[model samples]
Target: MRTLIRGMLEFLRMTVLLLFFMGIIGQLENSVVKMIIGREGYDGFRFGGNFMFLIGDLLLFMVFYRNYLQFRGWYTEEAERLPKRVTRMMLGFGFACILLPITIALIL
Candidate 1:
């Protein structure tokens, strides 16, 4: 029962994180594009939606990998630290969040 409850909580937490990421990235992208192109008649390709979708895909991968680890008995309360590669990916995502929107805005 405890494990089931914990799993549910983790799933909810990850879902919330995914939504937050999508919203933040989408809004930042929209704001940047509007600012760069003067909010005028610019109806070009929108990268923000693509990026948000990518975030969802990435979250799915994370959840699947976590489930695999749990099944293998590798994920436990004592092994709470995330892998370094995941941390780096998150850092890269953060950097891209700032850089990609500006680049896309300038290009469009």
Candidate 2:
């Protein structure tokens, strides 16, 4: 039961992290668009940057979703055998996802 709770917590943490990362990518795209518009007086940069950001966001979402699905249940013996660093990395990625958007928004 404790292991199950831990796994669920990890899954939630990962999902939140992924959402946060998506937000960061959005902010970055916004910044790039703002810059391009300010300097070049052209709208193409905004469109291209946004498009790329969308793609990246989608890809990250899929990856994180997959991870969530894979780990949603109780921890398996195999999962326990997995390196601690792998879990830490998953957590780190989630943290990055959350911060990136805020950072970009603030900078822009």
RMSD of each: 6.8, 9.2
Q: Model 1 clash pairs?
A: none
- Which segments of candidate 2 are over 4 A away from where they belong? 38-52, 60-108
Poorest 10 consecutive residues by lDDT, candidate 2 = 39-48
Q: Kindly list the per-residue Cα lDDT of model 2 for residues 1-108, writing each as its tens digit.
A: 887787787678766767787777667655664664444312343324444445556655655555554455444444432345665565556555444543454456
- lDDT, candidate 2, residue 19? 75
Identify the leading candidate in terms of TM-score: 1
